[model samples]
Target: MSNMQTLRFYVTPSHNCSYLPDQKAKTLFVDPQMRISTDSYSQLSELGFRRSGGHIYRPHCEGCNACQSIRIPVELFKPSKSQKRILNKNRDIQVIRKFPIMDHEYFDLYKSYIDQRHADGDMYPPTPEQFHQFLVEGSIDSWFYEFRDTDKKLIAVAVTDHLHQDMSALYTFYDPAEEHRSLGTFAILWQISEARRRGMNYLYLGYWVKACRKMNYKTAFRPLEMLIDGHWTHYRQE
Candidate 1:
């Protein structure tokens, strides 16, 4: 069957937009009954979709085009002076990739991250159930990349998905107290480097809302690409 015949989707009712304030948003999601495969998800990702937990979703909001899917063409990405600085600073931090697993230590770091950084967001009070559901039980290709300090103290966790030719960064949380170390930026830089090392083509960075300051970091990676109006276009801020 063709895509038109095999694919099933539903539009969510308008809800408060998470990326933008005072605006309502809707999402178009693939029916779980479809039992989407990693291959199918890769195709959807190129079409500007993202995976959250076990569901594939994209912003289908009406009258708003603020949400744009962003990716880093691994081979073409060149770090800026600031990024280079971040890399140098985090040289002591060790990165380890593991199959997604549930551990109390990870959840504890998650709780502290949410409490300090995401207090106003939907995940304010992070829970064990939500953590496993969102990061662990999603798909077989999922991985948990842990970042630890020189002393072996876990400092950050980056949830990622491995695909045929690329990897998607699902979510990242870190010790909010380590603000000066800039663990968030370092995590993304590490992922891009890892993707190149693994011979992956692109590293999907999820949605970026230009107006949202929290998302501005996604644009820092140069020679970036954004799926716009069904086409992927390379962009670089002057």
Candidate 2:
């Protein structure tokens, strides 16, 4: 593996913020042309960088620092009452981990999720090209954890990256009709268990925006550590 110290970094031009309205945001990203090693990727993740398809980046907005990277220390984590309920609720769902692929079943679920839940977001009008590029195109060590029901129907998919001593929960999409199941929460809980079982130390959750309601779900995971001013500290909710 090439030394990560040799990797080049770039900064994207300021653009409209996705999490905050009327705010501009920029990103600090590693050179896209480089094939980052698993160790290097994990190291970057520890420093608050995230993967989106082929890009490894972190929020680098000039004046706004709302995007804080978060991770759960698996050994130190304990599920909340609601999280346990989610696990119980999803007992019938089977999770299978496989290499990332551009399968139709996966894309269909992703399309349904983005089209319905995030129509107002940038990924609306989902296309196969977009789906493939966003989730399956990355060269990093990634896997797709398929969530299936008793009838063996695909319900949700969690794209996760296995890093050096941790795992990163990249993105998750599920059946809109299964909203009552809280499959998203279940996916995270399962990842936590899986990480612990694998002897990994943490599960990196991309970022948490305090002012964004959509990001509120991230806080429910107790003992979460947030990267603050280049330090990872236990997050205390206000």
List model 2 lDDT by residue over 33-121, tens digit each. 88899989988998999999988999998878899999999999999888888888888999898899897889889999998899999
125-157, model 1: which lDDT tens digit per residue? 789998887888757488899999999999999
Poorest lDDT segment (10 consecutive residues) of candidate 1: 1-10
Q: TM-scores for all candidates?
A: 0.95, 0.98
lDDT (C-alpha, whole model) for all candidates: 0.89, 0.93
Return the lDDT, model 2, position 68: 94
How does residue 6 of candidate 2 score in lDDT?
92
lDDT of 2 at 55: 88
